[model samples]
Target: MSGIYIHVPFCKQACHYCDFHFSTSLQYVDEMTDAICTEIIMKKDRITDQVGSIYFGGGTPSILPQKSFEKIFNTLTTHFSVASDAEITIETNPDDLDAKKIAILRQLPVNRFSIGIQSFFNEDLIWMNRAHNAAEADSCIMRSQDAGFENLSIDLIYGYPLLTDEKWHSNIRKAIGLQVPHLSAYSLTVEPRTALAAAIKKGKQVPVNDEQSAAQFISLIEKSGMAGFDHYEISNFSLPGKHAVHNTNYWRGIPYLGIGPSAHGFNGNTRYLNIANNAKYMTQIAAGKLAETVEELDIYDRFNEYVMTSLRTMWGTDLSKIERDFGKEFLNDTIENSETFIRRNWLENKNGTLTLTQDGKLFADYIASELFLIDEQK
Candidate 1:
């Protein structure tokens, strides 16, 4: 089944380390919503399959007015064949989740929440310039649960200078105590041109330590294991039967239609990237244009993408599918190239499925790149 992703490009505050496309000036929310709805309607005939998931990710989807959600849903229902039990998700900040707001959301189609609770400590929140405080971070979950929203996922950031080992442990324990169904943890990376990078360069802030980050990552795995959560993905943990369907579909290479500025859409063989600028996107949509670029994937590109995504999951890579869909040469190349990793016990090829061991997950990106077929090989 296919999916739909709507990007809300406005935020209340700018986090120091974020590099995603977003704007703090929210005066353009109405115009942006209109543009997104128009794009969805314009491409309604694009995907005839039933939409299994609808995700509202953003600068802050919770910041939008109730009418925005209504309008978007109205457009989607009218134009596309949305499934009756579609997994609808929204990304929110803790400060935006109040009782009144939760009550309003419970009536909508948002069945799941991906809260950006980066840290449970006020010190870290201030360091990251988050909009919410420690109290709000801890309370939003209970509020959502009280509102009868059971499917909950919270994001936690590790590997920052201010995050100590003890504090990280506390963070994980906090989620366990809250009985959060899913957890997505990430290492703090200093993107170029971000405030964090600039502060580090100017010695205004402590630089990120790779050794410390690696140590924290290992701690996360062990802690989550003790809590009975499955490390299904490199940075994601979930209780049984609590995996994120939308993101799972993405890793499995299912096609999805992306809406709003800076959104991306894929159809197994081709990719579409929307214009990143908000004003320009709306202006182009007003002129009856899609404001996007498309790319057609070749055999090598598709093979490499499959290797990258499948290898990251617990399911591993399917050698038979490779041989059947690609060719014997590609399968042979994969098996031949995987010899060193297998010998090192970093990878295991059982029944023709190759999977990364616990230790190998730290180097997942490196291993995937090594297994990639180069231009000459293709």
Candidate 2:
């Protein structure tokens, strides 16, 4: 089954470490909305598969007014073959949530809420330059629950320069206590071009300690596991039967259409990315062009993608798929490379499926690299 992702590239404030395409100036929201809806219609014939899920992710999808969301859904239903039982998700910040917002969202097709609750501490919120504070984070979940919404999810950042382990523990425990169904957590990495990167370069911001970050990742695994949450993906944990259908589709290599600025789409053998600039994307789409880069996937690229995405999740790399899709030589090399990591107790081959052990997960990228199909696979 395929999915559709709508990128709402507007936010009220910029997170220092965020490089995701978004603009704080929302003056172009109305035009951007129109361009996005038009693009969906224009690309209606691109993928003929039934949509199993629809995800609204972005700078903050909840930041859009209710009418904008309605228009997006109207366009989706009008142009795509969406199932009646499709799992529709929207990413939101706590500040934009209220009874009015939740009620309005529920009235539409949104079935899941991926709330950006980066921290339960006001100081961490401020450090991240998030618009929402500790108070809003505390109240929004309760308010959402009170509004009769279940299947709630939250995002958390750990090992931030300002986040102590105690503080990080508090954040995780808060979400657990709130009974959030799904949790997506990440270690803070300062990307090269972000504001946080500049601050650290000038010694204004403290550097992130890899050791500390690794420790917190371990903490997340142990704590969440003890709490009965499935470590479904390296960065995601969920209650049983509560995994994100949209993201699950992605990891399983399902096709999805991504809309708006800086969005990425994959349809098995090909991948595309929308232009990163808000203005360029809007103007191009307004001119009836898809503002994006496209690439035809080669064998090496496809095999490597499978290694990278599959190794990061509990599903591991499937040997049968490798043999079938990538051929015998590719499958053999993958198993051979995994032997060293398996000997080091970093990975496991259980029932012919290669999966990451908790210790191996800390170096997941390195392991994926070691197992990547050589360039000759191309």
Candidate 3:
């Protein structure tokens, strides 16, 4: 079984630090939805597996015009073999949720709400140019609960210039105290071509400090551990049984189909992404072309992807699974490359699993790269 992801690429406004493909212009909303539904039908035969989860993610999926949401959901139901108990998640920003709106969403098959609460501080939200305020952050969750939606996830952005260490702890406490089942926390990064990057370039915003980000991440780990939520992935924490089944499947290399502009699809050895331009995507899909670029994953590519993703999770790299999937040569090369980190007490191999120590996680990407089997240039 696989999952289906729909990217709603319209946001009320762009966050200063976000570089995701989205547009503030609302002119193409109807056209985009129609294109997405058409894309779904055209790709149905391409995806043969049953969809275990259906996720609406993006530039604030909650911002979808109510009728647009209805159309997309109805189209999915018509075309896909979605499971009755499937985990349906919708990514919404706080400002988009109100009592009446939450009630309407509750009427749908969506069982989970993933709210973008980047920060609970009004000033930080303003600095990031988010659409919601601090009050909206608290109110949205309570309103959803009041509307009888129990499965809730909140996202937090830590390690910004103004996010002090104490404040970071407070933010985590806010989620924990709310009894929210899942928390997706990320360290702020100034992506290229983003407003945050421009602000820093103009000397109006402070550059991100690696040391500060590291400290704040450590704070997140400690507090989440204390709260009994497993730091399951690099940037996600969940109470027992609260880990997002949809995302866990992705990390496990399960196949999924993504529909909408800039959406990505992974089917068997091939990976494809649709054009990021909204108008271009709609026009091409309307003309019967998928407007996607495809790539085939070779042995080295698969091994490297395995290393990068597994190392970010608490599960780490399973030597047995590696030997099974990639071959003994790949597994041996991985262990040999990890020796230096092992000696430094950063990585430890025990019971056939190479897991990271808390300290080692601070430089996860670099460490994973050292073990990457980047094939020789040919």
Candidate 4:
């Protein structure tokens, strides 16, 4: 399946822990939206398959007005053949989803909402500098449900200094109580140049505890399983058949066209990233020039990419696919590299499908890297 991703690079406030490209000012939102629409028109030829999913990812897609959404939707439908039941999603913040706004959205084609409700506690929101409060977090879900948007997912953060085990449990319980079909939880990482990183450097805030993060993750897995949710991806949990189509397509190496500034796209072998600055992106798009960088993948690059993405998924890596797509030599190398982990019970290889055990998922990144097709290893 193929998909489309549009990045909205405007936000009301900058979260201390976030490192994604976005601007706090709305001065350029209209221009940015226009540029995104133009980019879609300019690159429609690159999309060879029907778009089964279209995701509006952020900065904060919700910050845009309903007209912006309508304009972009018009452009998309005009340019590409969107599937009748395409999984169209918008990533939003809690503070942005008022009754009025929800009503506005109900008129649009947005069928899914990926809310950034990092926590349900005021302290946590304060620490992260999230614009929404505890009240808004709880209220937004109900508002969306009332507005008839039932296909919802929420984000939660763990391993932050303020989140206690008790609090983490409460967060999970809250999500379960809300009956959201999907949940995407992430561990807080201190990326360089971000407020969180700077605070840690100057001793203004505490650093993240890995051990604490691990325990919280395991707790999430256990709780979600008890609630009948699939631990589908390392960071995503969902009820059966509720997996995010756009993200699932991405993990499975399907082609997608990415629109807007800072968005990335992959069409089987070639990958591209659009210019990150809003003004520059608009200028280039207005001038009928492309503001992006592209790279063509080599065989080894493709193999390593598959290994990296597939290992994080519950479906596991396919050995036969490797042999068929990357040759038997690559398949043999994969099996050889996987031996130690399989012996350790972190990875299980059954009938040519290699998957990470529950225990191995904690070290998934390191394990996938070990199975990489490095030059010497290849």
Candidate 5:
């Protein structure tokens, strides 16, 4: 089954480390909403299969009013076949989930919440320029659960200078104690042009330590494992039977439609990247046009993409699928390239399926790069 992803591009404030496309000002929210709905109608033919999942992600989906969501849903149902049991999710900030907001959400079709609770410490939150404080971060989960929404996931960030080993442990323990079924923890990385990068360049902040990130990541895996959570993906952990359908589908290379500015869509063979500029996206949609560029994937591009994404998951990369989809030559190259990593114990090829070992995951990008099939013509 396919999926739909809507990127809401408005936020109350910017997080220091974030480089995702978004506007802090809510000046043209209504225009943006109208344009989003129109784009959905225009791209109605993108996916013919019943959409099994719908994810509202971005600047802050929680900031949108109920009417906007209602309109978007209405437009979606009108144009396409959405599965009755579709896993509809909204990415939200902790501060947005008050009693009133949770009540409003319960009235909608939303079944899951991906709350951004980057850290459970006020100092850390302040340093990150997060909109929510530690108290709200602690209470929002309980509030949502109290409102009868239990399919929950929370995000946590580690490896920043302010995050000591002790604090990282506390953050993990707090999420586990909250009884959330899923957690996504990421190491802080300085993206160029983001506030964090500028701070480091000016000596106002220390650069993120890679060693610290790796150690905390190990601790996260060990702790979550002890608590009975599956390290399903490198950065995502979930209890048994609670994996995120939308993201898991993305990793498995299932096609999905992307709505709103800065969102991306993929069919099996091509990718559509919507223009990141909000104003331009809205204007183009108003003119009954799509402000997007398309990339048609060649066999090499497709094979390399499969290797890149599939290697990051618990399922690993399948050699048989590679050969069946690409060719025997591709499969042979993969097996031949994987031999070195297997000898180093970083990779394991168990019965034609190759998965990263615990140590291999730390170097997943490098390992996958070494295994990629480069096009000689290029």
Candidate 6:
């Protein structure tokens, strides 16, 4: 079984740090929904297996009207073999999840809610220009649980200028205290072309401190572990048996279909990236065409990608599988390259599986890059 991901490209407002393709204006939401459903049909043959997971990510999937969701779901059921026990999720915001909204969602197949509760602090939310207030962030969770949506996850951001070590600790504690099954926390990054980046360039905002991020990341790992949450992936934590199936499949290199403007789909050997422009995407779909570009992965690309993604998970990378699939030469080179990190206690090669040690996860990117089979090296 594979996964299906739909990217909703509309938002109520812009977060200062967000660089994902989205529009603040929502006048064309219905048209966008139509295009999304059309895209889903157009790519029907892409996945022949039953869809075990369906993720609605966004701009803000919560903002869509029930009719729009119904229309899309109708199209999906008509075309795809969605599993009986599919883990259908919708990425939502607290402000949009009113009792009325929750009731509407209950009527649909949405079983999981990934809420965007970046902070419980009003000041911090205002700084980020998020739509919801502190009160909404706190109440929405309780409300959803009371409404019987227990398969839940919430997002939190740390390492920003307004977040002190004390505040960072508080944020982690608050999420755990909420008793939700899963949590996704990320250190604030200054993406180029974002408002946060522009502010830093103009000296209007203080630059993000790498040391602060590292310290807070360490704190997050320690605190969450104490609460009995598994540090399953680089940025995700979950209680036992609560790992996100869709995202876990992604890390495992399972193929999934991506729908909507700016969405991406990956088969085992190639990637499909859709156009980011809203009007252009709609026009192309209306013309019975897909606004997508395809990239076929060469052997080196596939090997390097596997290293990058698998190294971030708790299961680690399997050297035996590498040799079986890519060849003995690749496996030999990998072992030779990993010797330095293994000696430093940053990597562990136990039972033919290479995993990042606690200290090693901090340098995950660097380590993976060093292990990559670049064309020059090939």
Top-lDDT candidate index: 5
RMSD of each: 1.0, 1.2, 1.1, 1.1, 0.6, 1.0
What is the alpha-carbon lDDT of model 5 when measured against the actual structure?
0.95
lDDT of 2 at 338: 89
Candidate whose TM-score is highest: 5
The 0-to-1 C-alpha lDDT of every candidate, in the order given, reads 0.93, 0.90, 0.89, 0.94, 0.95, 0.94
After superposition on all CA atoms, how large is the RMSD of candidate 2?
1.2
Error of 3 at 344 (Å): 1.6
Kindly list the per-residue Cα lDDT of model 5 for residues 108-214, writing each as its tens digit: 99999999999999999999999999999999999999899999999999999999999999999999999999999998989998999999999999989999999
Instruction: Give TM per candidate.
Output: 0.98, 0.98, 0.98, 0.99, 0.99, 0.99
Residue ranges of candidate 4 with Cα displaced over 4 Å: 376-378
Q: Candidate 1 residues 1-378, lDDT tens each?
A: 899999999999899999999999989889999999999989887788999999999889999999999999999999988898899999999999999899889889899999999999999999999999999998999999988988999999999999999999999999989999899999999999799999999999998998888899999999898888988888899998898999998888999999999999999999999999999999999999999999999999999999999998888899999999899999999999999999988899989999999888988999999999977854
Reference-based TM-score, model 3: 0.98
Q: After superposition, which runs of candidate 6 have C-alpha atoms over 4 Å from their true positions?
A: none
The residue pairs found clashing in candidate 1 are none
Candidate 5 lowest-lDDT run of ten: 40-49
What is the C-alpha lDDT profile of model 6 across 1-378, one tens digit per residue? 899999999999999999998998989999999999999999999999999999999899999999999999999999999999999999999999999999999999999999999999999999999999999999999999999999999999988999998988888888888898899999899999999999999999999999998899989999999999999899999999999999999999999999998999999999999999999999999999998999999989999999999999999999998999899999999999999999999999989999998899899999999999877765
The sequence of per-residue lDDT tens digits that candidate 2 reaches over residues 1-378 is 789898999899889999887888889889989988988997788779889999998888898987888888888898888998899989999988977888888798788899999899998889899999999998999988888778899999998778888998888899999999899998998999899999999999999999999999999999999999999998999999999999988888989998889988999999989998888898999888999899999899899999899998999999989999999999888888889999999999998899999999999999998888667434
For all candidates, the clash counts are 0, 0, 0, 0, 0, 0
Residues 1-378, candidate 3, lDDT per residue (tens digit)?
Answer: 899989989999888899999999889888988999999999988767678998899888998877888888899888888888899999999998998788788778889999999888999899889899999999998888888888999999988899998888888889888889899998898898998999899999899998999999998899899989999988889999989988987787889998998999887588889899998999899899998999999988888888888888888899999899989999889989999999988899988888889899888888999989866784
**Per-residue lDDT of model 4, residues 1-378, tens digit only:** 589999999999999999998999999788888888889999989987788999999899999988899999999999889999999999999999999889998999899999999999999999899999999999999999988999999999999999999999999999999999999999999999898999999999988899999999999999999999999899999999999999998889999998889999999899999999888889999999988999999898999999999989999899999999999899999999999999999999978899999889999999999999866765
**Model 3 lowest lDDT segment of ten:** 44-53
